[model samples]
Target: MLVKDIMQDIGETKKKDTRFTNRLIPFHDVCSVSSGDIDNAIKSAGKEYLKDGSQAAGQKFMGVVKIRNNNTVNKESIINSIGDIFTKNHTVDLNDPDFTIIVEVFRNVCIVSVLTDYIKLRKFNIFGLFSGGFAEPKKSIHKDP
Candidate 1:
């Protein structure tokens, strides 16, 4: 909600302003890394965004976006774990997914959410949207050599 309002305000401004904010990424839930909290948080968020009957069976494409600041957490492990939750029902489309599961691990906590327009919103970067820059090239989970 707050991000939406900020985007609207930026849109209303005639002049492009780049100093106020840099980015605004929203999350549905936050939890500590201990006691399987990360898994629980992602599970809860998945239920809300990837509800059954939302699309035809096996037709929904989902992707995972993970950013880890904590060295203790393995990025691939987290991404694969989250992917396990929806793999049975959806296909993986890193280039352009219908829904994206975001897992941000910072120190001892993790923030999780599902975003439908992550790519369309310039990956939720306020500055990118305001600057009218070219859309970023599609990203893949695997790094290309």
Candidate 2:
């Protein structure tokens, strides 16, 4: 995978050679849908990733990160809607979640996936990876819905 190779190169060389690429997000599903259908799209795409009963039994923390390229979509509403899809046993932990739900909206298209170690990966920003700056855990004011 190109992403894996780039990440491996970054780790091995510690050199900042990337340009033009901002973030590398691997998605499980993608669909062309209106803002109104975002919730259903995410639900369908993320069902398998969120349905792990064994992991939920341990009360894993989950966080949602929504990136909207257009002004038509409400970011908070999307995040909350995705949060509701997770099992009740999962708690909200924005700073250091066990899993992160990514909702990337570009006009009428939406890409959805669940990822682990999102924070540690510098939110998948290639530039951030070479900066040697780590994301310090922050206190979250976000409550579980």
User: What is the lDDT of every predicted structure here?
Assistant: 0.69, 0.67
TM-score of each: 0.75, 0.73
State the weakest 10-residue window (summed lDDT) of model 2: 54-63
Backbone clashes under 3 angstroms, per model: 0, 0
For model 2, how does the per-residue alpha-carbon lDDT over 30-84 read when each residue is reduced to its tens digit? 8765655776777776565556665444344565556556776777787677667
Question: In angstroms, how far off is 79's CA in candidate 1?
Answer: 0.8
Q: Clashing pairs in model 2?
A: none
